[model samples]
Target: MNLSRPLLAAAAALLTLSLAACGSSKATAPGGATAEVTVRIPDPGNSGVLALGKKDGSLDRALAAVHAKVAWTGSAGPFAPAAQELNAGQLDFALGSITSAVTALATKPSFKLFAATDPDPVGEGILVKDGSPITSIQDLVGKKVAVNQGGTGEYLLLQALAKNGIAADQVQRVYLRPDQSAPVFSSGQVDAWATWSSYAVAALADSGAHFLATGPALGSDNYSVWAVRTVFADQHPDITKALYQYLHDGDVRAKADPAAFLNVFTDAGPLAVNGRSKQISVDFGRQNGVLSPIDDTVAARFDKVAAFYAAQKITKSQVDVRPDLLDITKLPGGSR
Candidate 1:
């Protein structure tokens, strides 16, 4: 994650040149300045609103106001690894849940929160086989529960345990990636699995695993969040602001017409959820997908979550994410 000054400069120059080469020189600014600029953003397998904007060219058009265009880059893995990409200067922007963001920040990664989704505790929880006798959160006391280390899965499990007045050490935490956890849980290697988003929906549909306890029922406040490379935000505040507004608009469109948003596609296929998991996906996004700019309220919520993670030893220590939040209104170009 460390880069010498010359190498960092070279990387930045290369990125600028690549963007300039792909941007449309014909685009103009109010002052007659050339608007040939492109901003690199991650296009992960399930891009959600990003796919809608990219497919409709709405994102590009939106960025045009800042004399910028979109440059979609393929990305992979969970938010923890994505944070590495941001720190390494491999991506300009990426999205993740607040749990993942806090975990990554605890390790001192170089990224900042720009926007966040309203926390929807639905679809996130611990799941067990439909007929399994482990019916309540208390039943998890001695059972093995699969969780993504220091990520959403772990956060959900710990939160549920705390809410039920159970200590985390009481349960056997089986840390695994989402893909890995799925098979293990299906094979009954783990007593339960704690997860969120499409993974949870797919698990219920494909494996018939019913929720032992859901986020809402457990009073969880896990949020869907977005992040930008710290250097990238500082260097291109205008593009950063434009990208945030574009995402907010796309979120609005998704909530307004879930079906249309689901229809958008990238090389991997449908942008949002479709097929058997469609309705649940729609419900989840509708109930929890509203985007809000990072403000005092949001910052305070994140601080609380960080403290919880630290208290439970899920994080090495509490991560103060307030310093990492980007206040777009305070930036020169961002004010517009």
Candidate 2:
């Protein structure tokens, strides 16, 4: 293959960065040069750190301990796309939902889940117009429910329906993003909406909106996972561990100062109804416990999620979440 000098240089630089990023933990890269940690951000994935980073620079201080700075990669949301970008090798580390990772892996993407957070199970919910007389999950049967296809919203709805004795095939699902879901839901375009995080909670506060059920109310303990390409993890175990610590620190700081980190999560989008920042913070803390190493409980939870996705046909391919979880032993925290 023929290559211009500039093209060759860029290729070489990429190779060097990748090697440095995935290499064993050291004061520097294989060549003694440190690589910055590239994080796909502005989503729920890294919102805690992003928010804390903005308010007091706590995330920065954590990053500095490993001598790595954060290089913002993609400025997108809902977590699904960011995970896709990471799997494609266009980005480095990513924040993703367990459902998103499972769906992607069912298709055989070279991805891995490094760490996990179980955000308040109730953080996600099935929403309806306030005072509409539909008070429980059973009411959603035959009703049009708005959800993000191939995301948490779908399975969360599925689980809710099953618990209420409403079959999955009974409800009409309107595939809508968070931005679209809120407005359409308010305008009566859909009978209900299912979503997660501060966005889901914000929608519930709408004068015309109320929750029929939440993740917990529906028997869900789904998790938000931190992931990287397997190839990347194989090469940079130390850097991978560093990232988990930094994010865990962010979660800790946010919990200690809940009022301080509210806007960070809300920054993903607007809140038509003014949100309760402190409550959101505490709830977020409750939903997502300390960032921890993946334990038997984590693996078991993921297995259930995989089986659920397969049953729901969210992923047409065979699903096995076990292979996708990357175990890092030397990390400061013993979670994974």
Candidate 3:
């Protein structure tokens, strides 16, 4: 994830432009700006569930109650690097995978973790076309696989293969964004695609596609957590709390009616999927889809990711994330 200076600058500029689309104005709050809390979610094309919140007004309605506001800036790469955007002031809040956050947090410890979600253990995984000769992770040797840097795809693929006796050098890992991976995997250009959530579901919809392995199989203690830039959290603690509170409420509403939620996603989503989002959303909701505040066990889980990455040498040095984790009180189920 070594971003060049020019590329980093460009990414920051793109994020800034995206934030501008979120709209800003002259206003003052107890902390500072009141116009918008610019947050970035993984922009997995139109099928992204996060986009639904922006379209259906659920996020807005939730924010309005707390006298808070949010401006979504969808980042196109690994959702993990949104933490980098947050640290760079290109984003205020971002949601990411456990592996992505822990790995990125190793380098960007300035990010603060507040809340975490218990993603379906099997929700994310390596997907391959049904008729492929590949059967086990061992078969990945000398095969091309699509993954995203700063995403679970690469991590899962690496761990799954290694466990089955394939080393990193034995396979060809093609790094592609979620959007890019879908069509590539669909066209049979790559042997497999490793991704999660709706994007994974979209790939799965190809009746010919099937799961080869999953995060759980590789001992991935995954969670989708929302984190923010430490400075922003320090300056606007109330606003941060309001955002998470709204998110918790939205989760409750989402669970109560997964189908309805999917409709909003599909209706608002620009991608023409044949009910992929619907199926993924409903099943995901039933997969212990509840969120919990940051606690010791969860924090340890994040620590494990750091250690995992270090052992894998994906990171040059070890990073301590506990110092940056903040326990925000007064969440839906109450904070730890």
Candidate 4:
């Protein structure tokens, strides 16, 4: 179902919170102790990154040094909703894909991207049923493809298709949530599905889908980013720094032991589908410790995304993606 323009407008309204209340803390800790920060994480699909934080005591260890308490919250919906809550001053931190962050910035420019948890954003890709004759972007002409609107999945597909000289009108676009797109794809309702990380891996395993191309093929530096409200960062700079460190540490642990990471995912909750966990375990290894620096590749990818959005008329004006919205140098350790 298409989300009504009015509903989306309302969402934009609720999503807009003033930065005036940004640095104010509701409660102060005793004896000048650091205030506790609540972190809201959208469900990791089958990643188990959240559970790992709890089990490894990484959250505790990271915050302990700063004398701050870490309150963890999770949701199963798209990252946009939780990020909206963060924009509304209900959350201190939130996890989201790079595209989600970009959308959030379009509405609320007060949030700052701090670090990247997943190394490559473009790892996500379009999956077609195995044995399908579709071997390249040109082959997708006149076929139905599913993707989440305004998401990395959609963005990557747009870029890939454009790079291959495929006209937008040549293919039918079916906007579906990542979860819904999978079943539709498996049922042959759509010729291909664009998805990322856990869901993409799950589709490959369950449906025997062949990869058209991954995000990296569209652009080398496509990667997800972790960001917090600007006020939260300004008020609690130490806590923000600690959180970045914690994410970096988690990446280290994930690299050293992926099976251990899968166990964490399984223990936290059942995978949306079985056998998907195994695939995720193998994929996470390739992504581990790959989150250190933002290079020219990332900047170039952002430019590509902005240009695509402009061409699609997704924005009324050109998006200036530097200084105002992206200040990579401000990240922990002054950017890599």
Write the residue-wise lDDT of candidate 4 on 90-171 in tens digits.
6666666766555555664666666654435434787899999999978989999998877766776777778888877788
Runs off by more than 4 Å, candidate 2? 1-22, 25-47, 264-287, 331-336
Worst 10 contiguous positions by lDDT, candidate 4: 327-336
Question: Highest lDDT, which number?
Answer: 1
Q: Candidate order by lDDT, highest to lowest? A: 1, 2, 3, 4
So what's the TM-score on candidate 2? 0.81
Task: Give lDDT tens digits, candidate 1, residues 237-277.
Answer: 77777777777877887787766666455324434455567
Report residue 188 deviation for candidate 3 (angstroms).
Answer: 2.1
Candidate 2 residue-wise lDDT at 158: 91
Question: What's the TM for model 4?
Answer: 0.80
Q: Candidate 3, after superposition: displacement of residue 145 in Å? A: 1.4
lDDT of 2 by residue, 78-185 (tens): 667776787678777777678777777777776788888874565677877877767877777788999888778897899887776777889999998777887888
Candidate 3: misplaced stretches above 4 Å? 1-58, 75-77, 265-273, 330-336
Q: Identify the superior model by lDDT, candidate 1 or candidate 4.
A: 1
TM-score of each: 0.84, 0.81, 0.78, 0.80
Residue pairs with backbone overlap in model 4: 121-222, 121-223, 122-215
Error at 59, model 1, angstroms: 1.4
As for candidate 1, its clashing pairs are none
